[model samples]
Target: KATMGVIERNGTYEQLGSITTPTLIVVGDEDAATPYSKSERMHFAIKSSKFAVIKRAGHTATVEEPEQVNTVISKFLECCV
Candidate 1:
């Protein structure tokens, strides 16, 4: 919680936008901690990034939707490789 506050205060939008590597930003549709919209913004900031939304999941998306998460990650990695 404290770390989140510190990071929020010291937002690194500049560094985020400077990423040259391919990035996959995945978020659960029902995630209250870090909503999909926030991830969407990050996807836009990254030049080579793919954004994925896991349905019927929350903050712990990997736990709640393991298969879906794995599938998304697999697809992203396939493109990367």
Candidate 2:
């Protein structure tokens, strides 16, 4: 509840548009804590951000689908570099 409230009132949303750095936003298709829609919203907020949704994974996508997560991270890093 507290976390949700903080997320709702956080200034990050307002500052997202100002961020010019490359960002990789990854989330699981089945994530309950932070769903795909929320990730999409973040992607839209950050102009230079990339969004990746791992299939058949949950909130702990990195742990549940390490290969997919690593691949996505690697690709993002490659592009950033």
Candidate 3:
């Protein structure tokens, strides 16, 4: 219910612009629950952020393409450190 409220109220959207920390916005090319456009919006909102789209994957990109997801996250972390 709380998660639904956050989504319905656009709470996270409202707060995205204020984020200053480095962020990695990842989405699957075929994501439906949280579409690619949403991830793009988040990438734009967060000043310091990177966007990655996993090809041939869906909403469960982490589980569907674990290796690709891990590689992207690893690369992002490397840049951060």
Worst 10 residues of 1 by lDDT: 6-15
Winning candidate number (lDDT): 1
Per residue, candidate 3 scores C-alpha lDDT tens digits across 1-81 of 987886677356888888888899999999998898888998998998999999989999999999999999999999997
**Candidate 2 deviant stretches above 4 angstroms:** 1-11
* TM, every model: 0.86, 0.84, 0.86
lDDT value, residue 47 of candidate 2? 91
Task: Give the candidate order by descending TM-score.
Answer: 1, 3, 2
State which candidate has the highest TM-score: 1
lDDT for 39 (candidate 1): 86
Off by over 4 Å in 1: 1-9
lDDT of 2 by residue, 7-35 (tens): 78846667788889999999999999888
CA lDDT of each candidate?
0.92, 0.90, 0.91
Q: Rank the candidates by lDDT, best first.
A: 1, 3, 2
Give residue 62's lDDT in candidate 1 (0 to 100): 100
